[model samples]
Target: MTQPQGALLVGSIAFDDAERTMRTAATELGGLLRRIPDGEVGPRFHWIMFQPDVLGQAEGIERVGEERIPLRMLDARPLRVADGVDPREIRFPELGYARAARESYALFRRLREEGVIAPGMRFQVSLPTPLAVVGAFFPPEQRAAIEPAYREAMSREVEEILAAVPHEDLAVQWDLAVEFQIIEELPGGVAAWWDGAWAGVVERAAWGVDLVPHDVEVGLHLCYGDVAEKHFVEPRDAGNLVRFANAIADAARRVPAWVHLPVPIERDDDAFFSPLADLRLPEETELYLGLVHREDGAEGAQRRIAAAQRVVPRFGVATECGIGRAPAGTTEGILRTHAEVAAPW
Candidate 1:
């Protein structure tokens, strides 16, 4: 079997705080990681679930429902443009990403200086694309009108993060979950307001890649929705992922340093990984397969790794998505699974 190279943490981790997350990751998976994140703790524990509240804070935006959605911890109601208020005129407050990154980087820097983290590891800051936030929080009619404003806000957030953190030690990853919802045309998924779904998605991705300077590393995290540990729809194969990745490689001004694709746990077969044979990422770009599932431990990851190696001879390993929402007591085992299945960098 072809042994996997390194490991990638897809942003969030379930640790109590950024310090613990960094400490634990360094202790267990340090040699295999090129970057580390702040565990997406607090409001970000549920990925973009808390974004509605942030958007609701803007003057012209208000939550559609009075109460939090049932069975969910965060206020995930859709927002609307207030009467007589134009969506394009709304101004968003600090969306919290840059602030969180600034705070986390302080801890990251301290840890590295104190020798808890390796000197070479970059701090990973993952941000959802504007389409993701706008699509998830606003109605279909409001999306197009509000997207530009939100995109501008997000661009500012990126600028803030870049300005605060040293480019040499920072790596930005654009999370592309909702784009898949549109592409798959899943029931109740966000529909693309732009002309062509594929072109629209790729354009947004390229725009995000352009936000970061060439000196800094940027990556793409292509995902299916990971609500309650389930994908909104299981991919038929790696076809869509391969096609989208190739388009981004060609479209972006700078090719992403890495691109990650999720692997459902049940798909440890050649059919699921076969489409990878056509992937056209440049030699400088890295590929990470999210095949590690704590439920099955390292043994199951090996099975998937073996299948993937049949087509793509070299790659990295990661969980299908962030582990911030993972059940208590599972994080450590998951971290260990990555270490056990992949070779050190």
Candidate 2:
């Protein structure tokens, strides 16, 4: 079997701080990782769940539901454009991504200088695609109206990150979780306001890829919703993932530096991996399968790896999503699983 090479952290480590996240990942995974993230700490520990609070800071927007959504909790209440307010006139405050990244990058730099983090590893900043934030927070009718403003705000966040972090040492990952929920038309998932689901998704993914200058490394983290450490919808196979990836490759200005896809814990069968045979990514674009589950540890990851090798001979490994929400005390073992399952790059 073709052995898995390297490892990718799909953002968010369970650590409480960036320092611990970086130091621990560097210590455990070491040479297996090409880049490391700031553990999506603070309000971002729950992925984009904190975005509603950020968006609510806008002058013309207000939370519409009766139940107050607590910070960092996954509540379904949506934000709405206030009466007599023009959605287009809404101006967002800092969306928090750039601010968090800037803060984390400082620690990353210090750690690297101290030789805690390796010299060559890039500091990774993962931002959700604007569509993710807009789609999740706004009603379908409000999405088209509010999306333009949010997209612009998100673009500016990307620009700020670019300016603050040096290109050579930076890597940006656009997280695309909600897009899959929309694509699969799963119940309770956000519906796309645009006409064609596939077109809308690819268009937004390409737009995000273009925002990062070619000099810096950028990648995509394609995902299904990761609520309570379970996929909103389990993929029957890798067909949709491969198709979406190929579409982004064809549509984007440049191929992504890497692309990650999730693997459910129950799937260690060849049928689940068979669709990877049709993946058309360029040789330069790396592929990482989120095959390492804390439940089964390295042993389960090895099973999934064996299945994947039958179709694609080369790839890397990751958890199905970020480890930030994994059950407590499992983070260290999960990191070690990646090291155990994959050869260091």
Candidate 2 residue pairs that clash = none
- What is the per-residue lDDT of model 2 for residues 1-345, given as tens digits with 9 covering 90 to 100? 667999999999888999999999999998999999999999889988888777887899888878886654545467999989988788999999999988999999999999999888999999999898888878788889988999999989999999999999999999999999888998888888989999999999999998899999999999987878889899888999999999999999987999999989999898899999999999999999999998889888898899888889999999889989888888999999998889998
Top model number, lDDT: 1
In TM-score terms, which candidate is top? 1
TM per candidate: 0.98, 0.97
lDDT per model vs. reference: 0.92, 0.90
Model 1 C-alpha lDDT per residue in residues 207-253, reported as the tens digit of each score: 99988999899999999978788999999999999999999999999
